[model samples]
Target: MSETTEEATLGLIADIPPGFIHAFVASLSVIVVSELGDKTFFIAAIMAMKHSRLTVFAGAISALGLMTVLSALFGYVATYIPKIYTTYIAALLFFIFGLKMICDGCTMSEDEGEEEFNEVQDTLKRTDEDADVESQTADPAEVQKRSKILNVVRRITFALFSRVFIQSFTMTFLAEWGDRSQLATVILAAAEDVVGVCLGGVLGHALCTGLAVLGGRIVAQKISVRTVTIIGGFVFLIFAMTTLIFE
Candidate 1:
């Protein structure tokens, strides 16, 4: 029995390709550099200040996981197509997203500034309300009734976890579309082990996003979003040029 069990374990381990570790390291390094100072990092930090840190981390990680899976799938499909064509497509997307981020960082309209301010104010107000609710006292029966009612409201509005998850998922997903990280994932998937690439990419995203959530207000205060965006944009552009030159 022991021999059979040992054999089974070794067989499972052997199922992973020998190249998987290399693929994972490559994916992790590329994604970490590409994603640093990206818009989504700032978004995660901002959301963390207003929502539960665990929820924000969970949502951001989940969104990145989903995006990695999609990119890997797309890369797998690209394997069926010509490699050169997919490389070109990935390079083009990286360049476009880089340019767009640079432009956005350089320009911010008054309306956009006002909208951001209003959002901050609303978040602060909500935080106060949450504190108040927690501090308020009532009869046990009343508290029970209120809890029931709040549960119903949460169900209807998809508050708490659902709200945070939906917001984070949508924002991260939309922001990631055509971004360099996703393109890199596609490129890596095409060139390396798919499972390893996905795992490493997801791990990289989770680390960055979790740090952002934990840093929260301190990070927001210390780093300007525009500066981060510009840095990320240049990184994307570099990745694009490297891909074009090498691949």
Candidate 2:
């Protein structure tokens, strides 16, 4: 039994691919840094303000994980092209990303991402009110006469989780469809190990999403948006250079 177990463990370790660690680390570091102050990050934070943390967390992480996997798949497809060309493409993409982020950072409004959160907040508030109104019975006396404990239990178990999860998932998925971080994942997956990139991106998204849900708004407020963007911009540029250099 011991010998069989040892063989199984060795087989598992041997099945692991090369370059996974490097790609995982690279993808993780880049995504975590870039996702700070992102719109989707704010979306998570804003939704958490009014919704259940677990619901929001589940929705946000799921959406991001889906996007990351899709991006990595696209990147893997691009790998069919010449390796040299793929490297150049990834470097070029990162360079363009760096420039774009820098320019946006330079010209960003003081309230760069705040408006999105406020809009989401107001819209969700209205939506929640509408939902409540729609769900109301014509006779409140009948509703009150029903078992209040059972009603509370039903709301907690069924109504609230579904509503918040759907909203959080829809909002986050839509917000992140074409975001920089998603694009970056695509580029990295194209040039690196796709599985590594996908795993790393998911981990990074989870971390960032968790932070947003927990209380990232406080840290966001403490730092200047402009500073974070510029820093991220520079980080992208450095990555671009390193991609080319290392390739």
The number of the candidate with the highest TM-score is 2
Per residue, candidate 2 scores C-alpha lDDT tens digits across 120-221 of: 667767977997896684477666766575787877766555967877888889988988898899999888888889999999999989988998668566
Report the Cα RMSD per candidate.
8.5, 6.6
Q: Which ten residues in a row have the lowest lDDT in candidate 2?
A: 112-121
Q: Write candidate 1's Cα lDDT for 1-247 as tens digits.
A: 6999999999998887755875686667667766655667766777887788888888888888999999988888777878788667767776786787788777844244234434654664686688677667556788788888797877866844587777777777887888878877887677556898899999999888887889845654555556656666776677667656655
User: Candidate 1 has what TM-score?
Assistant: 0.58
Assess each prediction's global lDDT (C-alpha) against the native. Answer: 0.73, 0.82
Q: Looking at model 2, how many pairs of residues clash? A: 0
| Candidate 2 positional error at 128, Å | 4.5
Clashing pairs in 1: none
Q: Which stretches of candidate 1 lie over 4 Å from their true place?
A: 1-18, 82-161, 220-247
lDDT of 1: 0.73
- TM-score for model 2? 0.76
